[model samples]
Target: MADNLPPPSPSTSTHHDSTTKVTDMDIDSLVHCASYLTLHDISNMVLSCKFLNRVVYSDTIWRRLYREQWPEQEPYIISQTSCASAREAYLGRYTDLQRFKFVDPLVYDVHMGIGAKCSDLMFSNNSILFSQGPVIKILSIDKLLEGKTSIVSLNDHRARITCMRLFPLKETSLFRNKAQRNESVLVTSSSDHSIRLWWKGSCQRCFRGHNGPVTILSDKLLGDGTGKVFASGGEDSTVRLWSMSSGGKRGGQHALKATLYGHEKPLVLMSVVKHKASLLASVSKDSKVRVWDTTISSDRSSCCVGMTCVPGVPVGIKCHDSLLYIAAGSSFVAVDLRTMKTAFKTSTRNQPKLFSFDILPSKFLACTGGVGRAMLWDIRRSTGTGDADPMAELDGHVGPVTHLHMDSYKVVSGGREDPYVSIWDADTGNQTNILRSSSNLNLDGGGCGCCGMAADGFRIVTAAYNGEECVVNFRDFNNAVFYGAFSDNVTGSKFWCPSTSGHDHAGDESDV
Candidate 1:
């Protein structure tokens, strides 16, 4: 009865204390408090618990977590947060994972020299062309498969060849009514300050005007039915146009059409789009990219002069459809020709010195930098609103990556590293093959400093700075072999030329 007496009536006088204390707990502690939850679960926890809600809703904590766990999604996450209502405005825009195809390098070769620096490579038809010093090496892609030893060397340039382009013409009877039925022409530029045209079995004419070394050269098919115009740019800060026709009295001679000059520095890269037949874009060391109109007036048979300068020091430029893509510094920028304005810019987080870039047919752009890393960007989905990230980062190269070349399914990177040439699957970023330079079959002391790679069908060609060149057939992986090696002191660029007539055309094709 005493224990139940109104619960002992409570004390009338009580001591009261009025003080609020805040704890110095770190972000990690706050995150750990919600350890039993996933990210979505944390969001739910935030709604139900005030303390957990404040910690989860902290922008600094979330941003740090986003970058640490998913760097590629940082751009999209940041952009989404800038909206007034991120939950409703950007619900489907930010996914934090990417899948890539990995390829291994199957073949490897090396070339060593004092000042070897391979500049370019091309794969055309069945032949491969690479430049070193003042010569172009040509070889047969098929012979490499048969394990035959035959290499054709052409001493065509007085200086080091810097660039090359294969002008693809149709083999149809309607197109080549008079000239060689299925032969193709290779256009090359060199430090000897000249541009030359060459056919497989013939030494063609040279275009001379630049006082300095020719830096970049490219061509586009203009008009129809045997009428075509080729364009070239050089260190002389000029772009020249030439018309190719069957009416030449001499073989491979075309009429010079026009010369456009506005660049203050040597042109490093150039690209032409088919949609804008009269429009051409060039990037120079002067830190500017210029666009020119090549359309001819009704009365004046010469190209019309219209130019615009875009600000940037572009190291590489590529165009697909009506969109122009340029790689500058650590960013890749895309411009729409229709709007003549930048549409997209994505950061690679790489250092500025880059040697080469290649765009795949799947709209993925691969860029290599001086820092020995290669990044793949999905430019098609990247918008200025920042909703994209690099799909993959290739980190195998030990030194600076000089060049990147890609086909529909595979990618090859060249630089100063193990296995001078490395091949990967474009879809998964997985290594499919390792082309080592240490094989006994290699003649160029294993391999040289690979500068560029080009592919035609299943055959691949690699050019090195030490004047070493190799052609490999990937059809037989276990027995995949090197075709030939050119161990000359050639440098600059190399490429492959495929002959429509099913002729062997692989070699160390070089300029200068």
Candidate 2:
């Protein structure tokens, strides 16, 4: 009976459970397992066997890795090569980021065709709207790629172009429901004492009444999201209301809706809230600030509900919930709009004194003074320690830091003290590269300082001197996509829509 229990086995007598081959698993299961491995680990895994090679390259595995590595890139990563797979997209950015260690090799180009020093610059779609003296040059990215070098010029302003801003255009398109983002109208102020509205690169209307140069343009639109109305201020010491629609207008006074007269000194900076019945704050050269109820700016008049004065002339003013943050010489102070009193003042411990300050998307404070270094402070941490360690110190400028722009990917600082634009990784707070002009005068020579700088994820636009010519240098990082000739996505992007969703998308903005 015992002999009938299967014939004698020729194999080894001791046998355990049969080993399960990884290749035997389903494709999905294999792909998921490989995802846990690092990119380098998967690279080696694929070479070990043909089956793993296929699994490592699967969309499921690569997509997860791509986003994890560069969450700021699209959820579906778009490869810089245009034809590569998700794996290629991940590899490209990974390699590009590695260039931070050796900055001299970072590839870039300078386009002197953008004209002399850009006093004001901005990106509209793909084309850049930059001011060179009084002329506005619109240059396309494709032209630069093809080496055309030619640009469209708009010389409507008689005097120098002082400031420029973009506000969301009211959606009137038949396919409005399908649009992912709102179209915008360009609102530019000039020393010519005029405020012009432009759409699709064409000037639609002009409103003129300022007695002196139009020195101030509200950074945000007034009212809700209509985009038809805006406000302007000038050295004449008056805040004038302007609208796109003929909202119950009388004769030819539609564009010049109303005038708000309260300030005594010349206008320095102004800010407007976008919410309904939103409040507008205007800062004058005399350091006095006036808060007006913009929603009440109807019936031919708007009332100044609150007023306050700062230590010295302010460089910037921004409106938040019930408060106005002013950047002055000694300190960055937040003044309560309701009570007209100083609510809180940022620490003045750092030397050189606070020349100006900005509120980052993180709600942390970034300040710049006469010194070369830009400091980041976490005001929240100060609650427990009375004084918190500086969150990050960006110190790479050759001299005094002039301007800086920060997004999720990196922090860019530049100034008149030096010619180079220092790019630092925001996450690591490490210097990545130094961007300069291709010209010998800009590269080896002195006097070429960055007067102004604007950056997106893929490119950096700088206002520098190429010898004696003030040139707007377009330094492209060779991104696979560009929206227009000077289209700037992300970086200094303004989110018009107010939200309290509480979802964190920190580096989620790829800004193509």
Candidate 3:
């Protein structure tokens, strides 16, 4: 009876307050539970106590949130945020990214020095590779930042490099633990009718089979970012298979494994797939296509499994899934290999000739060729209906658009007659900056007729002409901490590298 009457006496009888204080929980428990709070809830929670403030504002909270949102950027961005608080890192990374358009990039010019004409610009890790005629040149990001033009040149190709591709080292982590961290490999095809393999600044193997100048090469990477075999097409109207793997030798042939014949005209472009049945697709100048299966092998030249004709001259060929997507002049076609029938075909009806095709931003197909602008198309549409109107158009080029490239952030397009490359917001079609060559940085800006372009979030690589000769320009951005280190020593520019203080720079005259 006494225990029954004493139940209410804990609050009244004990010398303690009857309040629910957040201090009742330990800091570890509070911090752990902070993950469940919305950012707004956390903000309110911090107002209650200094202890709550520290818990909610923990670095782990911001870092986890950042990683959850932008997992793809972790590898490229982790180094920059190491010392900063996760809150500062998140703010800097996010705010700096949002202001990329407002800021200009520091342009570092590199004259290939071998010749004035170069093409097939590619990026592997932090290095840029391009072909100046037959000379393969590579420049690294670290050296470029030092205002140096250090280049590693390989002159093994006897003639001009017609086409090239890069297989970069595999990015591995807990996410992709099974990936191979193979050394970067460069494959280049030349007018000498040979395809050569380059590894570690030297030519490893020279594959000879094409009868005429090799026009195109497709070396699509597999899961490990390493493909032992590759495909090359040439003026000889044949597609040949070459391998750099150890057991490629047969009858004293080091790399040449098989040859395929199906096109009536010279092969203009080739696209590869890892699909079991349809391994490759090649397009010819005469609007014909030849597809080969995984089992396609021959002592001499093998017969293709099928051939299809695409409308107009083929300008681009890219493979996705089991379908071969070919972009010809004023038309786009996708062939379903399993059914061997046209899946989806779109004709612009001579609108402006689609010149290039690429997969960008959630696998959208973008083309640049019609009317000095880049057009984004919906590649998933399977009807025979023609998409006369592109989803969006990026304009401002004065001449016919010739070169195009993009990454997660921007779409860079150049024209045949325009010296400047227009940088556009990928999500919105707004033109952000018109980047020019720093060749005449002190006086007048020079021409940069972009031949090939590549970009990551931090840098832009262009195989372009600097009015005098072909130069590969490296444009650096997002170095917020390093912006204060401005110097007159070659790589310095106040115009390009703006302050990261979140000020309005929309009206700044970057031309100076």
Candidate 4:
């Protein structure tokens, strides 16, 4: 009996031992397995073999995974109608999030622990400029990426640095003396009531006239091909235009070209619109938006071309076509530059204090503020009665959203609490990745001061109120290094690249 039980047919044993190989699995089985893997893992699988790549990289699978990761975007992704369109949208969003399994440690940071509050920051010519107290610290972006300290600290102001604008001049026979053909000019304003001009890091000229802190800087090119000039608005309730004068036929320093006074309160923001001619738009603490003609830059030479009162103090203003998009308090107001009237006004949920709002090319406005969320509204679909709801909401930050920056593909936001710079897909409003800080740390009594897009298009540089500097590379979105103590407290910052061609202020006509 034992022998009979032990004896089994060779055919039966062979059949029982048969197993299905992985390569033999159907597309459904492969996709099911791929679903459990992270995007990076799936990418690795695709790269492992040609057949796997063809099988694993299907748009259907990607669409399913994208929807799973960002369900709120399902409506938009599904509305593409055509499979090709949906796939293209998915790839666009996916490529912006680029799959990465690991990230290198924070690449670079310099500790400029000068404990002054940083008011603003900017990036240009492979360098980053940030204002701390009355001094501006410049760090080379390329040097920072290599973990080296290449800084040029300029202490030209007596008080705090409030605003800065960089203008690229066209070097021709007429304006050859203004600057080197390749070099751009830097204009900075300070609480010291002075605006200084810098060419190649040296303070070339200083214009002192404002009785209070200068908070705004805007520049426009002269139509006569002479040179470009800039405008500044300050706490003294005046807008002053300055240009490199050709005094006595000799190249002169920056001189006061025009002074227009209209705002009853300190101006918070200003923009020079190139529409029809150079038109200047300024917002003051008095809740009034004033437009001026830059051509007639003297007192009484210009009347407010388009003026409107909003429900809250205007903090930010952007112009596109004939519309002026304004951010005031927690409400967003749209003004028709032609009619000089408020076309639409709407408040974010809970009336969160809106810090900054940018108008995107898609006719959508992206705004962030005291809330832990970023709000988006379609201006074309609004009801124009201060009752429009957000078309989509991006929620991730644990702290009040401080600043936002948007480009062709993504929207990046930073807050005071979260150690991550949240990045969202511009089209779908889906959070694709979080640029995590190396240290799980929060700023004490400080938050993100500002954020700006780099010339590389794939990088975003941000400054924190506690003097922290951050750089996020979209190609590797998961990791970022926080260079804390770069300055005491950064109030404002900008990113400028030498490789940046054309005038920096030219397309700024549409910047938010």
- Order of all candidates by lDDT, from best down to worst? 3, 2, 4, 1
lDDT of 1 by residue, 56-79 (tens): 765544545444543543444543
For model 2, the superposed segments whose C-alpha errors exceed 4 Å read 1-116, 171-181, 225-227, 246-253, 274-277, 297-302, 350-356, 361-363, 382-389, 437-439, 443-447, 478-512
Candidate 4's C-alpha runs over 4 A off are 1-106, 117-119, 171-182, 219-224, 245-254, 297-301, 437-456, 465-512
Model 3: per-residue Cα lDDT over 1-512, one tens digit each: 77666455565666666686778888888888887766668779879878888887787677666666556445544433434567776665553443244344566776654445767777777788777877888877777778776788899889999988875433211122335455566778899988876666876567788888999887563223333467788999887766545332231156566777667688888777646423677788998887776354453345466678877767777776777777787877778887768887777644657666665525555554566677766555536746656666777665667777765556678754556677765655556566663343221243345666777666677665545566666776654222211111112112222234432332222542
lDDT of 4 by residue, 310-390 (tens): 766676777767777788878877778888877777777675577667777354655545577878666677656655577
Off by over 4 Å in 1: 1-119, 169-182, 223-226, 246-254, 297-312, 350-353, 364-370, 385-388, 437-448, 464-512
Clashing pairs in 3: none
lDDT of 2 by residue, 1-512 (tens): 99769865757456756888988998899887887888779889878998888888786677687667545444334333344566664554544443222221223244554445775666666776777777777878677767666678777789888788887665212113436366776778899888776665566667788998998788876765553456788889998877756432131255776789888988888887423346778888898888887666444334788888877557666667666778776556777676988876655455435544555525555544436677665545433312234577777566666676766656777777577777665655666556663323444455567766776556667777645656666755533221111122222111211222222332111211
Q: Give the Å error, residue 318, model 3.
A: 1.3
Between prediction 1 and prediction 4, which has the larger lDDT? 4
Better of 3 and 4 by TM-score: 3
lDDT score at residue 392, model 2, on the 0-100 scale: 75
State in Å the error of residue 202, model 4: 1.0
Estimate the TM-score of every prediction: 0.63, 0.69, 0.72, 0.67
